[model samples]
Target: MGKPYRECPHCGAHLDAGERCDCGEPEQQEQTAAEERPRMRLIAVCREVDKDTGRIAVICL
Candidate 1:
């Protein structure tokens, strides 16, 4: 009935036979790279101070 199509492994886009998908393109690579890295946020900071020596320690979560 209809022409056969295949799914792109990288982006899951349906492509016609012999067609190329843009998932491996430079812009897509940059986007994927950004997505793969872990993102962190500074929730809180805690400080401990010694009474006699006046030494301080910092803890972050």
Candidate 2:
């Protein structure tokens, strides 16, 4: 099943989980802020060799 949908109280627009309608109401602003918050992710870099030829490639994530 998909996430339940909610309606914006101010604009009566449909919203998904952690989503806000375009009305930008104060109540929705807080949710939007939390959703817009920056998050940290792990990136990996590695060296790989191709089977066809003897070469090294640097991969960046």
Tell me each candidate's RMSD, in Å, in order.
10.9, 8.1
Model 1 error, position 33 (Å)? 21
The TM-score values for the models, in the order shown, are 0.38, 0.32
Write down the RMSD of candidate 1 (Cα, Å). Answer: 10.9
**Candidate 2 ranges beyond 4 A from true positions:** 1-3, 25-61
lDDT of 1 by residue, 1-61 (tens): 9758999999999999999998787897788999999997886565888889987766857
Each candidate: what lDDT? Answer: 0.84, 0.76
Mind giving the per-residue lDDT tens digits that candidate 2 earns over 1-61?
9648988888788888898676764677778888898987756555788878977676657
Off by over 4 Å in 1: 1-3, 28-61
Question: Model 1: which residue pairs collide?
Answer: none
Count of clashing residue pairs in every prediction? 0, 0
